[model samples]
Target: MASRLAAALLAVPSAAAAELPAADLLIVGGEVHDGTGAAGRTADIAVRDDRIVYVGPDGERAVHAARILDASGLLVMPGFIDPHTHADGDLLSSDPDRRENPAYLHQGVTTVVIGNDGGGSPDIAEKAAGLENAGVGTNVGLMVGFGPVREEVLGETNRAPTADELARMQRRVARAICQGALGFSTGLHYAPQTFAETGEIVALTREAGKRGAIYDSHLRDESSYSTGLKASVAEAIAIGREAGAPVHIAHIKALGPDVWGSSGEIIDMVDEARARGQRVTADQYPWRASGTRISNALVPRWALDGGMPGLRARFDDPEAAARLRTEMAENLRRRGGAETLLITRGIGDADRWDGKTLAEVAAAMGSKPIEAAIAILRRSDARVASFNMDRSDIEAFAVQPWVMTGSDGSTGHPRKYATYPKAYRDLVTSGKLDLPTFVRRSSGLVADTLGLTNRGYLEADAFADIVIIDAERFVPRAGYANPEELSEGVVHLIVNGSLAIENGRPTGVHSGRVLLRQPSRGTCP
Candidate 1:
């Protein structure tokens, strides 16, 4: 091995060779996709410590290396960066395996952004510290969520915040940004964020914007749930315009039968915003079904006023119960009837509902779908995969340049484990998206959108976060019914210059870093 490495280094120019220290690892002979949406080129990459030292033509000047990997006939690219995810639940869990995040590593994801949908701790510093101390398999970025900030200042009540409360919320957002939060996120579709008016969102978002943070939103309506899909897109754009922040729509989709063909209109809206010099982008998961709690799918915003306890109380009141059922029935219809809602996770007795459709449960109980839904919710907040999306809509969004790949990974959903590979198979293998575009959207596009430096790219001086895949073997194994299966064909994955996956298996290394955002000048004390 030493003699071969020496012979390879013979071609190096004397001056340049002297400056190039022995690389920790050298990967040679692969089709390199640099995450720029450009065509792949055959090249070699050398890593030392946590940064790439070289990326150029194969075997031209292969400096000395302690370890050399032959990546011939493989796809080498920047490790995927999941722009939106719920993986923090696992990263912060006490379970060691969960912290390792093999499911994601298997999918070739080296970094994940959390605190999405307005649901992360406002204390970015504390959260970052906790994650680093606990150890993680993938680099994690923190986003200060609007949901928690609002919930902290104003309980779960469905009412407008007063001037004082709004100010307090603004302070929290600013503080989080200064403490290194990448940006501010909101899941306006979920309460108590649902109760907030557009102006209120703009007010709080301005805090993040002033600190150079973007606004990532889970639009208030993906279907005809409330503000209507197109209107909701406009509202998000308007919020960003008013707040002076770039707008990013999380898990962008045209959900439900009502908005099945709405992707084209939504794209036009985003295009118009971009044409006017507004920064607008989005992330998408390949799956047709969206995952969420059963109550979130059926319960009306007004009915969720005080949360579960309040909803339970109203379930017993005759008048309120009648009204609640009426709205829930309509919601059920909007979601394509009970048959389309497949329960993926539940609590206690409701656990049996897993892998069963709402319609199936309702049939077994000899109860109406609404009653069955309520009964299940009363027992536990069961999560369901609502298969309401149209394939054409998903494909339409996939082809958009601004729409990058994201998992929105949550438990009981195959996206958590198979999103990246599934995207490769569905989009690239199917010829809908070329390999370069797929890699670009999965990695560089996300990094640029999130303002992450030296990430989502494979270049000298860039972070050594990389993946090697056997293209023919890369495919997703997980499904809605079996959601925990890890993907196959990640031959090697490097996180922070350390091997996290080798030869299609985890190396049990916890080399991930908590990537913190640097506050803009004068933004921090």
Candidate 2:
């Protein structure tokens, strides 16, 4: 099949070669996937400066080059673009190595979208400036987060904002968009964000919509939490409809056992919205367990109104404590069972809980599961790998053309380092999806969804962000037990025309750029 596909590449005119100038680097004789859902073709690509100068057959003979990278017998394509990630913790860190982002570099990800789940800083300009000054390993795109916008105006209280406060929040969103934010994002499932009504979100989102920014959201509910999964998806669509903004769902999934087989229903909702001429898209990771803090998985949002101090105060009150315990027990049941929650990371003495299931920790502590969870949270909010998704549902979403791949990459989860390769192996290699489809979703599709220009494609005038992979070796080594393990199989990687990884090893080059949105014409002053 591979031989047939390669042989089918007929000689086409080298139009780009004739028009382009001399090349700095020429990559030759690779099975190229141009990131447009087209079949693999054996071709050569030429790069001069930060843009791809030419891509055609026999580029070595047509264009003169200073350096030649032999990508023979390898898969060459656009580097993966992750649409949702929590990489801000590493990208903005004081440590230089962390800023280099070796974990994602090895996974073939060239750009990552930060400030996901509504955790984006309200000060997008300041954050972009900081990352620019501090060299990073991959290109970054920023979003104006709803969490910080709400908190900046109305503390972390669980109440609707007054008209004046709502106006202030709207102004902040307008300011962020003008400052080059891609859009407004919301993690409606989290505290503070969870307190906002749909009306409040629409009012604020309109500011971004008026400026032609997208509305990306971590849905208000993935399970039976507050609104059901289907209802929450409807809400997201409605918000986008009312605000006149494109909707991008972050980590779209049927999260817990109670919602295990609901991916089909969720997909239909998105499709129906798209059918109505509404722009709606979503991203999903190829993993059974989703990574999050234990507190977020089980604690009620109202109980966390005043943050940790308020929660501690409630624990001391017998009546409040009893209610909290009852609700927590139900939440635990929704997430499968205590045994399904594996502690992945913790701080101080709580670190001892790593690698153990919540049920196991409860047994060791000689207490009920909810009590054990509270005890662990009291010390430190430990991160957990909650195994709740069903395999059938994952594949159902994977086959959808509108759904792209995102890592939601956070620490303590293998998805941080393995999302791209794992998706390739599971979806493409397993015959669930073809190679072209996989490359398209991981690359060009994401770029289109986010309104990114001149990236996520291997063509003339596009940024030279490319990945060369040994297909056999391109599999994830990371797992729940060893979450930080760097992925294998990327033989070469180029970020903005600089070799960041060569011959399967990092070159320690931080050539990544901080990509900011260009405000639509007639919208910004």
Candidate 3:
């Protein structure tokens, strides 16, 4: 079959090469899912100078020139645009010689939005320049984080931003957007950010929102931790209203036992919001377990109030330490206890503790699970895969059209290398969702959400970010035990007319660019 397809592609008996405009590459006779939420058609895709010049039936306008690739019997679709990721840190920290992002390309991702969770750099232009100058494996976009902006203005003080300080934060957010941040993101559940009042976040959102930037957030709380998951969703929605920007909830989930069936409620709220003309959407990983640091899940946000100094001071005082322990115990309960947390990435010296459950580690140390967790936090924090979600909730959210796919992570969880494929294999292929809908949510919806002009679709003149997949073989090979393994079955990947993956092998081409938000497209400086 491979040979036949190759023969068919090589024999390009159409318009003469000299008669047609030049093309960098041509993919012929494939099932073309145009990333438009419509059924695919058999067509040929042609790339030239970083853009798709043609997409139609086999002997189309863009076909005569360039190399021919036979994608016959495979799915040729838009290379995925992941809305949330932490890969910027990865690429920046990668060995200079090996800057290619294997984890994403292996999973068929061609673009990733970094600096997510309110932790993306404030100096987006600087990061963009660095990535472009150093060369990157995939097209990367930035989102200025609320966390950094707040830290810059408030210095981790547990208080509301003064009016003057608030003014400075607004300027920072506006500056990031002008320099090309796709949106403003918030890790409201995390520190310094958690110290912010709802009104303060609304003020920051307006700065980005008025620039047509998206308001994306890892909600203040997903479980019953702070205001309960429902209230957190409502708070996000309210912020959207005050800011006049679309609201996007990050890694939307009904986390923990208390929030088990809350997917229904969350879906309804978003549905009703849209019905009322509010633009609200959310991204979710395919896996049930969520990835985060050990301190984040078990420690109460209140105890970590004044940053490291406050935390150290509390730990030093015996009474405060006892109170901290009690609060930490309650926080652990909300996540269904320590057994639900699996340490995936360990800190220095404690590296041997990876791959063990918190409960198991506690048993080995002859200490209570909470005590062991506290000790581990004191020594060093490790990333964990918290298995506190219900399978029903994951699927329930998966089927919702407003719920798009995002890894919400990097390295520590299987989702980093498996989110899209898992969704495709389990949802689309298994008939829970039709193919068009899957493509729409995964690529088109996300692109539309971010207002990316020529990406996430296979139309003529769009960026040549495409992927050819063997649906049957495009499976997530990485498991919790061996979390670093790359995914499989991406036969070809093209990013901005450069072949990053060709015929099932990585070519290490850093053909990616930092996408700038066009001011003409309703964005402000």
- For lDDT, the strongest prediction is 1
Q: Report the lDDT tens digits of candidate 2 across residue range 323-343.
A: 999999999999999999999
lDDT of each: 0.92, 0.91, 0.86
User: What tens-digit string does per-residue lDDT give for candidate 3 at 1-525?
Assistant: 467545554665544545667777888888999989989999988888899988887544445545778888899999999999888766776564345778888888888899889998889889888888888888888899998898887878789977899999998988898888888999999998998889998998987778888999999999998899999999999999899889999999998998999899989999999999999999988887899988789778877788766776787799989988898888888888888999998889667788999999999999999878877777788889999899999999999988888887566788877788888888988889998888888788989998888999999999999999998899988889988788889999999999999989999788888887753254552
| lDDT agreement of model 1 with the native | 0.92
TM-score of each: 0.97, 0.96, 0.96
TM-score of 2: 0.96
Q: What residue runs in model 2 are displaced by over 4 Å at the alpha carbon? A: 1-20
Give the range where candidate 1 is weakest over 10 consecutive residues by summed lDDT: 57-66
The clash count of every prediction, one per candidate, is: 0, 0, 1
Give per-residue CA lDDT, model 1, range 286-362, as digits (tens).
99899999989999988889989889989999999999999999999999999999999998899988999999999
* Model 1 ranges off by over 4 Å: 1-20, 58-62
Better of 2 and 3 by lDDT: 2
